[model samples]
Target chain A: MTTTQVAPAPPGTGTDRPAVAVRGLVKRYGGRAVLDGLDLDVRRGECFALLGPNGAGKTTAIEILEGVRRRDAGEVLVLGEDPSLAGRGWRDRVGVVSQGEGAGQALSVRETLDHFARYHARARSTEDLLAAVGLQESAGSRVGRLSGGQRRRLAVALGVQGRPELLFLDEPTTGMDPVARRQFWELIRGLRADGTTVLLTTHYLDEAAELADRVGVVAGGRLVEVAPPEELGAALRRETTVSWLEGGARRSVRTQAPAAVLRDLLAVQAEIPGLSVTRPGLEDVYLRLVGATPTTSEGALR
Target chain B: MTALHATPAEPRGLERLRWAVADAVAAAGRDVAHWRRQPAAVLVAALFPVLLLLMFTYLLGGGMVVPGGGDYRDFLVPGMLALAMVFGVEATMTAVVTDTARGITDRFRSLPMAPSAVVAGRCLADLAGSVVGLAVLLAAALAVGWRPGGLVPALAAVGLLLLLRLAFLWMGIYLGLLARDPSMVVAVQILVWPFAFLSNAFVAASSMPGWLATIAEWNPVAGTVTAVRELFGAPVGTGGGWATEHALLLAVAWPVLLTGVFAVLSVRRFQGLSR
Candidate 1:
C-alpha cells in the first residue's frame, strides 16, 4: 500500500518534479520517534546535503528514501514511485553508498564491481569505474586487503557502476585522506554534472559547504532549516566580528556591518594593527542551529 | 554513459525467473570463490569426516560388535557417511552467520536481484561441498576394505545422505541467522558433536540404556545411518523399536520434516531482517 499522506507541500517544490520527496515521514524504534513527521524534497540534478548530529535520523531518513527501510507512517516517493512499492526498476535508478563498508572482502576490486554491475540492466565498464575511483591499479587486490580509503573508493565505484539517476551517499568520505576526499569530491561533481540527483548525509560541515546545492539542518527529529550553504551560514547569525590591536590590548567588536566599524576605527587612527574581519563559518552556524537543544554542547561539534 | 542513465523496466514472468536463476548461480559462484581462495580450509572441512572414519573404524572397531555378526568396518563406514552429512551443518552455519554479521547479506538484500537468490546460492554451494565430502569419504572407505552390495542401492544410500545434508542445511541457515555473532558457530559445533555421538552414527542403539537407546534410535541421524547400512547390506535387524525397524521410511521422512520446519523458519527470519 502506497500511503500517499498528502502533506502540505514544502516551500519551493515547484514544477520540476523532485527526484526524492517525503512527507510527514515518521519512523519509531522502541516507541521513540527516530523520524517524526519530517518532510524533504531533493530536486533533479542538485546535490541535497542532509546534516545532523549522531542519532539525528539522517541514516534512517536516507534508508527510507533508498527503499530498503520502512517508515511507520508517511508518504515517500523516489523517482516518482513510492519507495515501499518500488521494485527492481526503481532500485536500478538508485545507487547507495552506505555508511558501512559493504564490499565483499574476498572479491577483488574489479571482480566486486563486476559482480554488482550484473544486477543492473546497464552498467559502466569496470575499467572506467575503476579508473574513475582511482582504483585501477588495485583492481586485482582483494577488498579486505585494501586500505580504508581504498575500500571506500571501491564502494563508491560500486555505487556508481550502474550509472544511477539518483544516488544516496551516507558519509562517503568518512575515512578518506584529504587528497582522496578531494578526488571523491571531483567524482561527485562529475556525477552531478551528468545530471544525477544526489542526496548525501555527512557530519563534515566543509563537505556540505563544498558540494551541496542546498543543505538541510535536521534537529529534534525534523529538518529545522533547508537552504543553500552560504544562505544557511548567513541566516543563522548575521553578526560579523571586527578585531584590532590598540594600545597593547586586543579589542574586538561584533556588529552587523564590519566595514562600518573598520571605517570608524580608521577615522580615529591611521591604521589598526592586526585588524581582521570575519563572519561565522558554516561549522559555527551548524552548531548553533542543531545545538540549541539542552543536550547540545561544545563536545557535540567533536 | 547516456544509455546507462536509462532505468530498465522490472522483469516479467520468464525473464524474472531467468534473472533469479542467474543471480543464484552467481551467488553460488561467490561461495565457490571463497573456497578457491581458501583451499586449505575447504580441504580440511571436506576431509575431516574421513579422519573420523579412520579413527572409529580402526581404533574403536576392535571392541565393537555388529548386530548381525559382520565386519564392523563395513557397518561403521555407512554410519560415518551419515555422520558426515550431519557434520555439514556446522560449515553451513558458520558461512551464513559470517555473511550476516559482515554486511554481505544486507548488501545482497539491497540489490535489484531476486530476494531468494542469496539463500538458494548458499544451499547450492553447501550441498555441492557436501557431495564432494561424501565422495572423498566413500573413496577412503573403499580403500579400507569396505565393499558395496550393489550400484543401485549404494547410489540410493548416497541420495539419502545428500537429502539428510539438505535438511540440515536449512537448520544451519536458520541457526546462523538467529546467531548474533560468528562466535555462536562454536556453540553450534560443540552441540553438533554431542548430537552426532548420541545417535547410532558411532554405536549401536541396542547397546545403550533402554531410554537412551530409544532416543538414539529415533534420532534423524540414526535413521539415516541405519537406512544406509541396510541399503549397503552392511548390518541389519538391530531392533530398537518400530521406528528403527522402518529405517528407510524414517530416513526419508526425517529429512522432509526437518526441511519443512527449518526452511519456513529460515525464510521467516530472512524476511524479518531489517538491517
Candidate 2:
C-alpha cells in the first residue's frame, strides 16, 4: 500500500460548489415511492459512499444523478446544471459505471477501452489505464474469456478512462475477491488524489468505512444518518462491555465505564485472566441504524 | 500518454455530425464483432434461403407454369430474396431481445453518446448483415442456373429487397423493444411463419382458393415478393388483377410505409426511455 498521503487542497482553492447536488428528490414506481424526498450533496474531490440495503433506492438515486433515469420530482444539479436538461458538454464531464456487464463478450479488453476512449476529448491512455486496473496481461483477451473479477475491473477502468470530473460507481466491486477489492480501493484513492469526485454505493460495509470519508446510511428510501465512521460509532461508545474468565468460567458485563469496572475487578482478582474491553464498530452502528440485531449477520444490510 | 493530443478546434455542425457518426460506427463495429465470434449462426441463416431455392426449383419446377412463360428458377429467385428479407427479421429481433435480457441496453443508456446511436447503430449493422446474407443466397441461386434478365434490373431488385429488409428491421426493432422476454420473440416469430409461408414466395397466388387468394394477394409480404419478381424478370401470375398490374409500386410502397411508421414510433418510444 502506498503510504504517502496527498495533502488536502487549501480552503477556497476551488469554488465552494458541489459536484453533485440533489434536494427534494422523489421517484415512484407503480405508485410506490422508491426514493422519497431524498437530499444529498457531494463535494469536489471527495469519495462519498451511499450505504443501503437492496431496494433502499440507492440504485434509483444514482441512476437519476447519472441522467439515465428521470425522477418524479426534484432539483438535481450535476456539475451546476440540471442533468435532465443538460447537454452533451455536461455528459462529457461525468462518467458512469452501470450495474450490467458492458459491450459485447467478443471484444478484446484493449479494443473495448480504446473504443470508449474515442467518445471523450481527453482520456487516459489505454495502456496506462489497463496497467492501473491490473488488466495489462489480459489486454488481448476477449471480455467473455476473462474471470468475473477481471470483467469488473475492466468495467471500472472504462468508467474512469475519460478522466471524468464526477464519477458514479454502483457496486463497482460486487464480484471481486478480497485482494482485488483492496487493489481497487487503492485505485479509487488514486483517482481522488487526481481531483475526481466519486459517488458510490456498495454492499460491503468495510469498503464504505475504508474508502469513504463520510458515509450516508439510507433505509427505506430515506437517508437516516450521515457521518464519518468513527463518529457514527461514537454514540454507542459509552456503553462498552468488559469480559473475562473467572474460575475457569467465562463472564461478561456491560458498563458505562469499562476502566472503573476493570480497576475494581483487578483489585479483587490481582490479575484477571482474559480481561478485555470491547467497543462497538462501524458494523454495529450500521446494523442499529437499519433496525437490525448486530449479533447475527443474517437479514442485515446487503 | 500522447500528451492528451491538443484538443482540435472543430466547427460546431461538423463536430456534432462527427460525434454522431462515430457513435453509430462504434455500435456497428461492436455488432460485427459479435457476428465474427458466431460465424456459424451467420452461415446457418444464409443457408436456409438457398436450400429453399434449390428445393423449389428442382422438385416443383417441372409442372408449374410461370404466368410470364419464364424459367421457374427465375420466378422463385426474387420471391426467395423477399423470403431472405423476412427471415433476417428473426436475427434482428433476437439481437434486440438478447441485449435487453443481458442488460446491455441499460449499459448503453448510461454512456454519454448520442441518444439515437444505439438503435441507429443496431439497425445499420443489421442492414449490412442482411446484405451479406442476401449476397450469399444470390450466389447459390446463380450456381443453380438462376439468372436475372440484366445487370440494371438485378441491381434494382437488390435495392427493393434492401428496402423491404429495412422495413422489417424497424418492425423487429419495435417488437424487440416491446417484448418482455426472448421467448416472447420466439412466439411472435412463430406467428410470422404462417404469414411468410402463405405468401406468393413459393406458389402463384392464382392457384389459391378464392378467400385465401384474396388474403395472399393483399398480403404486404406478397406485394413485396411480387414486385421483386417483376423487377427481376421473374414469373408473377397475371390473373391476380390490379395487384399484379401495380406490383412494383405496391412493393416499393409497403416497405416505405412500414419503415416510416415504425421508425417514428420507435424514436418516440426511445425518447420516453427515461421513465
TM-score of each: 0.90, 0.89
Listed models, DockQ each: 0.37, 0.37
* Highest TM-score against the true fold, candidate: 1
Clashing pairs in 1: none
Interface RMSD values, listed in order for every candidate: 6.9, 8.4
Per-structure clash totals for the candidates: 0, 0
Q: lDDT tens digits, residues B134-183, model 2?
A: 89999998898877778998888889889999999998888788774889
Model 2, span A163-272: residue lDDT tens: 78888999999989989898999999999888888899998889998999789888878888888766875666556767788789877776666777777786776788
For model 1, residues B1-275, the per-residue Cα lDDT tens digits are 13343335667679879989998988988888878878899899878988998888889889988775778898788888998888888999988988887767877776778889989999999999998899999899999989999999999999999999999999999999999598999888899887988888777888889999888899988888889998898875465788788899999999999999999999989977863
Cα error, candidate 1, residue A11 (Å) = 15
